[model samples]
Target: MTYRGRFAPTPSGDLHRGSLLTAVASYLDARQADGAWHLRIDDIDPPREVPGAADRIQQQLAAHALHWDGSVQYQSQRHDAYAAAVDMLLASGHAFYCALSRRQLADLGGRHPGPAVAVSPASHSATNTNPNPNTDCAIRLAVPDTPICFTDRLQGRQCLSLGEADGAFVIRRRDKLYAYQLACALDDADQGMTHILRGADLMDSTLRQVHVLDCLGRTRPDYGHLPVLTDSDGNKLSKSAGAAALSPDTSANLYGALRLLALDPPADLAGAPCAEQLAWAIPQWQPARLNNTLTFGVADAP
Candidate 1:
C-alpha cells in the first residue's frame, strides 16, 4: 500500500503553535516515508465553524511551506457520502436510530447508556425501519461488547470497550448533521490513508473510528499520537483556551516546534528559512524521541 497520510484540521480557528507543531510533525512523517501528505478541512459542524477559518488555515500552511498533495478536501461538501455510509450501516444492522434524548439517557443511569444499554432491533421505533433525511432521532452504531485494541506508535498499547466507554455512540445527530466520528473514519479509509499521526488528545476517538471502519468493512489505518502541547498553566493549548495563533514570518517557531518534538534541531537552523530547516529535519524526524510523554508545556520549549 502507498504510505498515504494526512493532516486534518477542524477550521474553528487559525493554526496555533500547538497545531503548527502537529502540522510539522505530520508533514515530516509523510515526507520521510516518501508518501503523499493530504490536507483536509474538517468544517462539517457549521455551528462551530468560523466564517473564513478554512481558507486562512490553507494560507497558514502554505506560508509555512507545508504544501500538501492533491486538492484539499472539505468535509462540508461530503454530506452525500456520509449519508450513504450511514444508510449502509443502518440497512446492514450495524447502526440504529436512537430516539433517547440526553436527559432520557441520563435518566436511565448516566449521561450515556453504558454497555448494558444495547438496543435490540425489536426495540426500534416504527420510524427506524425507514429513516429519512428529516428523521429526528440520532443514529448510533450498535458497537460490539468486546474491547477495541490497537498499539500506538508513541502512546503504546490501547484497549477500550466502545460499549462501556461511550455506549452506542452517535454517528448522526438529531438535526441531520453527521457526527465527527462517522465522517472522520469514513474519510480516512476512503482516502486510502495508511498511516495516521495526530495529537494524543484525539487518541480516545481512534477506537470509535476503528469500529466504524470495521462495520463498513474498510481497511484500518496504522495510528500514532504525538504528545499534546500544553500551556504554561498546564492546560492543553486550544483555540477555545485562547492559545496564540502561529506567525509564519519566522522559522524560529518551526525550529521551536522541532525542539518540542525532541528533535534537538541544530543552533544554525534557528532562524533559517522554512525550507532549509525542513530539509535538515525531515530525515532526522524521530517520533520516539517524545519518550511517550503526553504533554509538552510552552515554558518547556528550549
Candidate 2:
C-alpha cells in the first residue's frame, strides 16, 4: 500500500519548536517512504482559533521548504461530514445521546454510563416527544470493554481499554459541536492516511481513534508517535504553556530540529539551505533511533 502521512496543526497558536519537530519528523517519514505528505489545519474550535495562526503555520512550513502535496484542508468546512458520521454512529447503535451532565457523572463516581445514563433515542422520543429546547444531550460512542492494542514503530507495543481509560467519549458536545476524537478519526480515514506520525502525548487518543474507525468499519492507520518536547521546567513545550514561537531563521533552526530527531547532520551542513539539509537527512532517516521517551527537554536541542 502507498504510504500517506500528514501534519495537522491546531490554529490556536503559532508553530513552535515542539510543533515543528513533529512536522519535520512526519514530513521526512513520508518523503523517505516516497509517499505523499499532506497539510491539514485543524480549525474546528473556532472560539479558540487565532485569527492569523493558520496562514502563519503555512508560511512557516514554506519557509522551511516543507511544501505539502495539495491544497490545505480545514476542519471547519467539514462540519457536514462530521455530522454525517455522528448520524451514522447513532443509527447503527454505535453511539447514543446522554443527558447526564459532568457534575452528575462525577456524583455517580465518574464511570462509564449505564443504560440509565445512556438515553436511548426511542426513550427520548417517547419521553420528550416534542424535545425540550433546554434539554442538554451529548452524543457518545459506545466502546467495548476489551482492550484495544496497536504497536507504534518507535514506542513499541501499547494497549488500553477505552472503558477504563476514558469511558464512553463524546463525539458531539451538548453545545452542538463535534468532538476532536470524532473529527480527527474521520478526517484521517477520509484523507486516506496510511501512516500517522505525531507527538506521543496523543497516544491515548490513538486508542479512541482506533475504536472510532472500528465502529465505522473503516481501516485504522499505522501510528507512530514522536517524543514530545518540553521546556527546562519539564512542562510540555506548547502554546498553552507559553512556549516561545520559532524564529523566522528557518535554516538556522532546521539543523537543530534535525538533531532533535536523532539525525546526525554533518558539520558542514549546519546553516545550509533547507532543501540541501533535508536532502542529506532524508536518506539517513531512521525512526527507530528516535528517543522512545514520551518527553524530551529543550536542553537536549543541539
Candidate 3:
C-alpha cells in the first residue's frame, strides 16, 4: 500500500511547541516517503474546543510550510460514521451498553485496580441489564483477555493485557459523545491512513485503537510515536496544563521544534524564512534520531 500518514490535533487551543513538533515530525515522515500527508481536526468534544483553535492550527502549520495533501477533516461532522461503527460493534457483541456512572466506576476501583478497569462480564449479564441502551448510558467494548502487543517504530516492543475485572472500555461517553479510541480507529481506516506518527504520550492509546480496529475488521496502520515536550515540572505540555500559545515567528518556532526533535538544523537557518528552513530540513529529517526523550522547558521557547 502507498504510504499515507496524518497529523491529528485536538482543537482545544492554538499550536504550542509540543504540537508543532508533532506536526513537523509527521509532515517530514510523509514527505520523506513521498506519500500523502493529511491533517485532521479532532474536534469531537465541544466542551474542550476553542472558538478559532482549528483555523489557528491550520494557519500555524501553513506558517511553518507544513502544508497537508488534502482537505482537512473534522471529527465533529462525522458523527454519523461513528454512530454506525458503534452500532456494528454492538450488534456483533464486540461492545455492550454501560449504565454505570463515573462515580460508580470510581467506587469499584478497589475491586478492580490497574491502568485499565472495567466491569466484569458476570456483572453485565446480571439482572436489570439494558443491552440496547439510551443516550445517557455509555457504550463499552468487550476487550478480549489476550495481550495487545505491537512493535512501536520508536518505543520498540510494547504490550498490555486488558484484565477481566477491568470490565470494558467506553466507546461512547455518557453524554452521547464517541470516545477517541473508537473515532480515531474508524477515521484512520476511513481515510485509508497507512501510518501514524504522533507523540509518545499517546503510546497507551495505540493498544486501544488497535483493538478497536480488530473489532471493526479494519487494517491497523504502522505507528511511530515521537518524544513529547514537557514543562519544567516534567508535565507534558498540553492545553489543559496551560501551555502558552505559539508565537507568529514561524522561523524560530520551526527551528526550535526541529531541535527538540533531535534534528540538528543549521544555526544560520535561525533567521531564514520558514519555507527555506523546511526546504533545508526536510531532506535531513530523520525520525530514528529521536531517542524517545521527553523535551523539558519547551514552553520557554524563544
Candidate 4:
C-alpha cells in the first residue's frame, strides 16, 4: 500500500523551531516513500487558537517548499465526522457518558479507581446517581486491563496499561468539546493515513490513540516519533514554553531542523536555497539514525 502521512499542528501560535523539525521530518518521510503528505490544522479549541496562526503556519511551510498533497483539513469544521465516531463507539458499548467530576475522580486517585469493564450505554444513566443535580456529563471510553502495544518505527516496542491511572479516558469534555484523542484518531482513519510522524513529547499519547482505533475497529497507522527539541534548561521546546518562532529564511531554518534530526548536510549546502537543500537531503533522510534518542538541544542557527 502507498504510505500516507500527515503533520497535524494546533493553531495556538506561529510555527516554532520544534514544530518545524516535526514538519520537515514528516515531509521528508512521505517524500522519500513517494507517498502523499497531508497538512491538518488542529483548530478544535477556539478559545486557544490564535487569529491568524493557521494561515501563518501554512505560509511557513510554503516558504520551506513543503507543500501538502491536497486541500488542508481543519478539525473545527469536521465536527460531524467526530460526532459520528462518538455515536458509533457508544452504540458498540465501547464508550459511555461519564458524570464524574474532575474533583471526584481526583479524590478516587487520578487513575481509574474501580475495576475496568466494558460498560453499556444504558449503564451511563443507571450509574450516575449523584443527588447534586448540577453535574455535566462527558463521554469516556472503557479501558480494558489488556496492554496496548505498538512497535514504533523509531522508538521500537512500546506498551502502556490503560487501567493504571484513570482507567477510563475522556473522549469528550464536559463542556461539549471533543477531546484531542478522539478527534485525531477519527481524522487519521478517515483521511486514510498510513503513518504518523511526530515528536517524542507525544509518545505517551500513542497508546490512548491506539485504544481509540481499536474501539472504532479501524486500522492503526505506523508511528515514528522524532527527537524533541529542548531548551538549555532541558525542558522540551514548545509553544507553552515560549519557544521563538522560526524565521522566514527557509534555507537556514531547514538546515537547522535537519541538523536537529541528526541528518548532517554538506557544509557547502548551507548557503543553498530551501528547495535545493531539501532535494539534496531527501535521499539522505534516514529515520533509523534517530533511534533511541528522545531529545536534542536547539542551536542558535541552521
Question: Best-fitting candidate, measured by TM-score?
Answer: 2
Sequence-dependent TM-score of model 2: 0.93
* Deviation from native of the Cα of residue 293 in model 3, angstroms: 3.2
The digit string of per-residue lDDT tens for model 2 on 130-233 reads: 32324677778988878999999889999998887658888898889899999999999999999999999999999899999999999999999999998878
- Residue 211 deviation, candidate 3, in Å? 0.5
Against the true structure, candidate 1 has what lDDT?
Answer: 0.85
Clashing pairs in 3: 117-166, 118-166, 118-167, 119-167
Best-to-worst order by lDDT is 2, 1, 4, 3
Candidate 4, residue 106: Cα displacement in angstroms equals: 1.2
* Better-scoring candidate (TM-score), 2 or 4: 2
Q: Positional deviation of 144 in candidate 4, in angstroms?
A: 0.9
RMSD of each: 3.4, 3.3, 3.6, 3.6
What is residue 234's positional error in candidate 3, in angstroms?
Answer: 0.3
What's model 2's overall lDDT? Answer: 0.86
Q: State how far residue 299 of model 1 sits from its true place (Å).
A: 2.5
Please give, for residues 1-302, the per-residue lDDT of candidate 1 as tens digits: 67999999999999998899899999999999999999999988999988899999999888877999999999989999999999999899888776665656665554344323433333432222433334457888877878998999888999898767767888999888999999999999889999999999998899889989999999989999988899878888998888888865658778888888878888988989888989999999988887578898777766
Residue-level lDDT tens digits of model 3 in 1-302: 79999999999999988888889989888888889999999998899999999999999899888999979999999999999999999899888776665556667662223223333334532234453464356788876777888998887887877644364687899889999999999999999999999988888788889999999999989998877887778788898889988888888889898777667888899989988887887789877777555454645444
- Model 3, residue 254: displacement in angstroms? 0.4
Error of 1 at 111 (Å): 5.7
| lDDT pick, better of 2 and 4 | 2
Q: List the residue pairs that clash in candidate 4.
A: 111-165, 111-166, 112-166, 112-167
Best by lDDT: 2
| 3 or 4, greater by TM-score | 4
